[model samples]
Target: MPQLDHGANALVGVMAAFGRFELQQELSGLTAVQAWNLLSPFLPLSQTDPMAFTELLCHGVTPAGGFAAYGASRALAELVGLSFDTPAAQAVLDGGIAFLREAGVPPMRVRPYEWDRWLDTGGNVESWLPVRPPPPPERPGITPLRPAETRLVAKLGAEQDSNRVFISRDGTDFVAIVDARYSDEDPTRARWVWHRASTLYLLYLQVGRSLQTPPHWVAAELEAYVPLPAPRF
Candidate 1:
């Protein structure tokens, strides 16, 4: 795995690799101290550094050239969840939850998805532009929201015109939905998909399982994930 010092873009690549490989075993010795060193190298002091950790989280995922702070925070939360049995790790989790509860406004919510929205010739509204791509698939077993209210959070890829990230958060928990685009004219080309392939998604899923409160529908699906059966000869 790339060191967090390398930057968030590198971390995002690492998250995607996890989905393609069953390498949870690789993380076997990944203790909270190690995870802290890997993710928040900004604080070289220790794992229990809530003041520094919270400040970084509040910085809105601006690790060099990254925009997904939620993803990074979720990744840390996953590590915290896996090792909550340890007193030190538990302290980190406690500090994080407390930070969330006490924060007047999280940086995650305050940052703009696009720093250059003024230059966006297309504008931002989903409907005002053109075709209404079918909504992303309802999570496997979760009841589909008839008209789920979602807001665009980030746009991924080089073109800055595709792979949209949308989210619906209800204060305590949030579900991120990906609306992947390929062609503008072909409605069939558009697909709504889970963000599972991304490290951010996987981290959130792992941490969600460990949260005391009910996990979001998307995160819950990770627990139920099963590989396809092999072809029988």
Candidate 2:
């Protein structure tokens, strides 16, 4: 495996390092190798041609690429073990993070294999990118989500016996779920908030957590959930 230039092997190695269950069965009985050993062939490439290295793991133009980038980058970062003691490892980790930001956020879409609908789109962005996406510029009149707005903000899951929805668009945008009973008349179902570890919630983080000019309609709707301001006396 000396000429492992394509990086799928490195990605797979990272996946195994992270204990991906599927890889477990396939990799068993093999002499255990360190994640670094798997990534060794790519280290020089990462230092000299980081973007090319990124392209090896990232399928930039594909639908699933958005969903995969952060997880892949984070896995690489963790496998490398980010610490000052390991500057070489840190540089490699930094390169991966740089590649993610350079690639930018993909246009909003549902995760591959998901139903083609907006609610499902929330799961597309996957995870918080390794670096902080620059914050959206502050607008003079911009305000945060309010109770009224939270009520209108779309819930994460569809209507079912017990489904979770995002009831608020405040703070970092990963609002905690509130438990309440669901009713036919009330669209809010038991305030059942399911935390999707990956998805457009990452999109929120990508845009620096601003609702103004959201990246997608669901986000726009969440932002628009606010009521018109009362006339100031």
Candidate models: Cα lDDT each: 0.36, 0.37
Per-residue lDDT of candidate 2, residues 66-174 (tens digit): 2233344444443333331333333333333333334443222112221122123242333422322343434222244454464333333333433333444444444
**Could you give candidate 1's per-residue lDDT for residues 32-64 as a string of tens digits?**
454444545443422555444434433423232
Task: State TM-scores per candidate.
Answer: 0.21, 0.30
Stretches of candidate 1 exceeding 4 Å from the true structure? 1-46, 60-67, 79-233
lDDT of 2: 0.37
State the weakest 10-residue window (summed lDDT) of model 2. 224-233
- What are the runs in model 2 whose C-alpha is more than 4 Å off? 1-80, 103-151, 157-189, 192-221, 224-233
RMSD of each: 19.9, 15.4
Check candidate 2 and list the clashing pairs. 122-200, 126-199, 156-165, 164-192, 180-190
